[model samples]
Target chain A: MDKEKYAKLEQKISPKPPLLKNVIKAFLVGGTICLIAQFIALFYMTFFNFTERTASNPTVATMIFISMLLTGFGVYKKIGQVGGAGGAVPITGFGNAVVSAAIEHKSEGFVLGVGSNIFKLAGSVIVFGVFSAFLVALVKTILVKMGVVSW
Target chain B: MFSIYITSFIVGGLICVIGQLLFDVAKLTPAHTLCILVVTGSVLDGLGLYEPLIDFAGTGATIPITSFGNALTHGALAEAEKHGLIGVLTGMFEVTSSGISAAILFGFIASFIFKPKGSV
Candidate 1:
């Protein structure tokens, strides 16, 4: 550990998660999430007559929704104990963030407290990402219009 | 195809190994290391140098947080073309919504039960 960097990082508020467990959790949770998604897709294909390709998207959406529900119910916490970032970095993790924030502040009243801040940190990140992409796209369009480069 | 899969697995493993070395042996912090790898990958990709690596590795490149940033950039750029200045937000969220949704759902669940033991 770099003393200087450690000192600096230590000042920041974050969990001191166990490395091995988190890594294992990430692998297991991430894989399991993917496996569950595959199962959903297979089920859709088998019962509903959806094509494999067609089944993929709805399966993903369903997975995210289920993940959100889990996060709302606090079951993901148990998964996180084993999966860490493997669980946290996936789409399900994002759902957890918004819902959890809402749950945390639900006492403030649904609209102002829970609903308003539901996106909170994750919202900002998405917003920033979207905004920045728009700017870049605009520039590219302007350049393209001016015959600067071909798409 | 089999060779490609094997190569991807190896290269992806190597990236993790390098990440581990950086975390365990180097003086650099995890965020810093992650940042460096992602930025390096992005810059190389922007310069058209990383495509071959991506082709060979697939998820090796996409699994990293930096790839997430690249996806955001690509999404924003694509949307901005359609929606003018507003595309930034539109493009980014549209492309990444699935991932974001997933993250939020899981994060929410974890937070409720584990309560994150620490503060932001």
Candidate 2:
């Protein structure tokens, strides 16, 4: 049996993400958010008993907590304006989804408003997260079955 | 240590730059762009490529919303390997449970404390 070339396989495996300079503001904002998150992760590791792997969960929690406050204060919207996707692409964006939707739908009452709409923006992300995982796993499982790869 | 910060910033920034381009040039909404990035991240991780990127850039790789997809896929694949096909379904949310749970809990609480200020 013949195997594919490694370079060709690399192309098949990973799509090249864009590296072109588009908006400097987005770059700065997004990068800054991640950098801050790195610090938070470090803090968890330093002060707590979290390892590198475990620290991510707490770090993400803290960032979302920060974003929830910022969104309530109307500050996150400003950051979204300045940063565009930068503002919306981090875990903070998930916070924005819940906070913004809850605020926007408050007049509709609590059960219908906050409870239902809290996940309005975020629900799609979750759907895609689960759906994509299933699809990719299916493919990987098939590949492993074919003996082309291991798990 | 210093290098970790630099790479994290640059790679993370680069990802956001791509997102900006999707908005400006591709004309996709933020939702669509995020969806696309998530799929890309999952596909890449399935191919065994995203781990290297994560290894190199640290939080730069993990902090993006795309990492959610990566984590989900990683969990699913790991579970599939360990416990067979059924694990694929079960393990998908294993690692990503925290981010979504935190967002929900904090968003609910914060909404009570702070009413929405209208866009004045």
Candidate number with greatest TM-score: 2
Q: Which regions of candidate 2 fall more than 4 Å away from where they truly are?
A: A1-22
lDDT, residue B79, model 1: 64
Each candidate's root-mean-square deviation in Å?
7.2, 10.0
- Where does candidate 2 clash, by residue pair? none
Question: Per-prediction DockQ, in order?
Answer: 0.18, 0.50
Q: Which interface RMSD values do the candidates have, in the order shown?
A: 6.1, 2.5
Best by lDDT: 2
DockQ of 1: 0.18
lDDT on C-alpha atoms for all candidate structures: 0.54, 0.86
lDDT, model 1, position B32: 50
In order, the first chain's TM-score in every candidate is: 0.69, 0.83
